[model samples]
Target: MRQYIVLSDAPWRSVPSRTQQLSARFRGEVLYFEPPGASKRSHRDPGRQVRPNVILYTLPSAGLLPVGGGLARPGGWRRQGAFISRAVLRHGFREPLLWTTCPAQVHLLDHLTYRGLVYDCAADWSRLSPRWEGDLAAAADVVFAASPALADHLSPCSGNIALLPNGVNFPMFCRSDLDPPRELRGIRGPVLGWIGSIDERLDLSPLLRTAREHPRWTFLLVGKVLRNPLLAALQALPNVHFAGRRPMVEIPEYVGCFDVCLDLRRKGQDIYEIVPRRVFEYLSTGKPIVTPLYPGQVEAFPDVIYGAHGPEEYSLLCERALEEDPAWVSQRRKDYGAAAAWSRRVEEVQQILGDIGLA
Candidate 1:
């Protein structure tokens, strides 16, 4: 058994990722810290129990150490690092398998004691500085990237980086035996669905245009919606239903009910290389998908999904996807998700740990 300390950039409330999956595999206990907002200190300290051996807590930031009214002191990097150190010790964590997904958490290296540290580069965090990137790479026993583009991006900081793609829970998502989620039972089909953050990265235009062209087709979007004009437009459309955020356990049932799925990422240099998690999740269900023609999308699902090149064909491709036989499509991509399961991906991570003499 091993003890692990995981510092995360995503809020505890968000969807699961590689960091969470890795922690789940460890036989020992894990103290997982959640990301704080804008350097503010909240009074929360429950350390929510996520699994049998894993607990989660949000850290404090120096910028917002409330002073009853407004009296902020030095809650800078050093102070925040010290705060984190104390928290780690408070949970009886010492010399554990320390991992961080956030490059900004590199500062914790200066204050905490750990047996080994691994930097998993799964996100393109905007606030990360070049100095921290180098610091993290130098300090990390292993640095894993979620994509080929990400591995190349980190090549400047380290020569020894591992390519670790994001994975799905295959059995949970790929099976068609589960009944449709109760929330989706009454919703009309020719149903189109999408799951993940409905943020700016999403190209809402395709959904808007498709819904307008075919009002009878009900579009189900399940995820948190960040403020955007496109979201407002989608909300106004009578055919679109925003299910909001649902529990992770219910996600598979939600996707299982879909006649088809959509992956519409906006065109930009920022996320041109991102292989959205939903793409793999939808693939697990063997549901036919329609997406934008991004390089990553084209490479990952060339034969599996319908890629629309221009705005003129977005709705047309979706219409065509509805014609695909679900059972045939499911069988075609049946083994693909098995190779992309989180368990298989973490097995590789365990080997990395063994190779580095940490196991």
Candidate 2:
């Protein structure tokens, strides 16, 4: 079987299911590289493994400040350098194919004279600096975009750009026979849950407003708190419950516990083209989703309850979602399930890779 290395600045657990699914499809080994202390509690350090056929590296977020010398002026760059120095550069791999999930790492590709591909999976390019996009376009042999809008923006730079949207692990998120964990079971009222990093990108104001408007409902947030002050404010609300970040394996249990799932993306120009991972995950759970309507996203997921600006629309949608019969909701979830399967997505990616000679 062919071998591949996935060089990421962080551990695999952050995007576990996606990494595992890709690993299975390529039938290749993964060589993840994280800073010394950044290893996940459950998995082995991927850097310690032997070299593989490909090196997939994730880039730093462009929203971050620029560090000196073209490095992201943030902590991630320092961490990334540690991994690259200790694991990647130190190794002597034979003609490894390079794939970068980060746009920032495109500059680093010049140092590696080998077959390479760049997967610019982020939907936040409109928010990214023009220099970063230019660097990515110049470095990547094949650029995989996350949406059509993103592709349009990148078209001026690379002809090899391909639109590959996000996908979910079907079996994990799909309606399962498994029982819900004890912590999730006792939640008395309708649970409006949102799972993801609580950051500025998230418009929790509307969710909080809706929660306050409908005091009877319980709002559950399952993820790490990024903006502490903002999150603390959200926590101050009586109906909101911040669950912090849960283990990846426990995510499905949390999803299964939701009466309705939320995709509360803050309305921004960058978010217009972004299709969040939670949308597919919510669909897989066979749960109704309440989200803001973006042109690109609505085109992909028309069944979602698209809320216009304001708490009234959001609250009404949540009420409607909560009122739906469990059987009907399950069928809607199945409808979404049929549409966003990873198998189909992987096939699309495989075709893209083959066209670019990366497969």
Candidate 3:
């Protein structure tokens, strides 16, 4: 099996990122590098091995500043170099495939040996530091994008970019045996639900207006909340319920209870690069989805999700969504969800690496 050394800004345990999913399904060994300040707890030298197949390496970043050339600067360079050298040394300096989500990790190219470099980019390059822009333009031998929009955004920087959208853990999110979590037992339906980070991505205007427009419809919002401006409006609405982060296993149960799943992420450039994995999960449950008109979602799932133009259209779409033929929608969603399974995505990655002679 081919071995891969990974570098990502996301902590493995926290969000179960794209890198984490890839590692879990990878046919070979995956070494995941975790720097300080990523998680709440600080890790010492010689990272922790959480799984037999994956290793989490923790080393000091020596205060690697967030801007351009921070990783190459005097203090940052030595620390980053030493950590990568020692980590590679422990593995006898094998020539493993290098995979990273953040372009900033490209600094390791100066210190380690790799058979080939792959950029697993999930967000727009513009959102990253200008320093990494040079690395993105010159360093990676191959690039994998989580959405087609991101692939288009990175196309100018690299000719080898691939459109690899997010995949879902099929059985986990598509549980056929359904029991609504007891926490949601009291909420009366026709439930309109959303599952994802409750942050700036969510447009408050539409949700507020919809809740006010339909007092009888219970609105369920599940996920961690961050930098939200209209938390007050949600709090005031008795019809709106916020279920904080639930265990990964219970996500389907929580989602399955919904009559219609809502994807209310604000429609703008911030969303252009992201194709939420929850869309697949929602499809797995065979529930109708109402979301804003996003280019990424439009590209991947054109007729699958109910795309609305504005707040007023949200209620209208939700009504239409609930009225769709369940038998037809269920079978179609099941087929789509199964086709976009994580295993299929992983196999596609394996094939790509093989085609490039990296696997």
Query: What is the clash tally of candidate 1?
Result: 1
> Best TM-score goes to which candidate?
3
**Which segments of candidate 3 are over 4 A away from where they belong?**
38-45, 66-72, 266-271, 294-299
Of the two candidates 2 and 3, the one with more favorable TM-score, higher being better, is 3
lDDT for each residue of candidate 2 in 96-203, tens digit (9 for 90 to 100): 455565556654554444556555454564444677667777667777677787777778888788776777777788856768777767678888999888776666
Against the true structure, what is each candidate's TM-score? 0.85, 0.76, 0.91
- lDDT (CA) per prediction: 0.76, 0.64, 0.77
Look at candidate 2 and tell me the lDDT of residue 22. 53
How much is the lDDT of residue 137 in candidate 2?
Answer: 74
RMSD of 2: 5.4
Backbone clash total, candidate 3? 0
Residues 176-217 of candidate 1: C-alpha lDDT, one tens digit per residue: 788987777788758898887677766777778888898999
**Clash statistics: count for each candidate:** 1, 6, 0
Cα lDDT of candidate 1 equals 0.76
Cα displacement (Å) at residue 82, model 3: 2.4
Report per-prediction Cα RMSD to one decimal: 4.5, 5.4, 2.5
Better of 1 and 2 by TM-score: 1
Cα lDDT for residue 210, candidate 1: 86
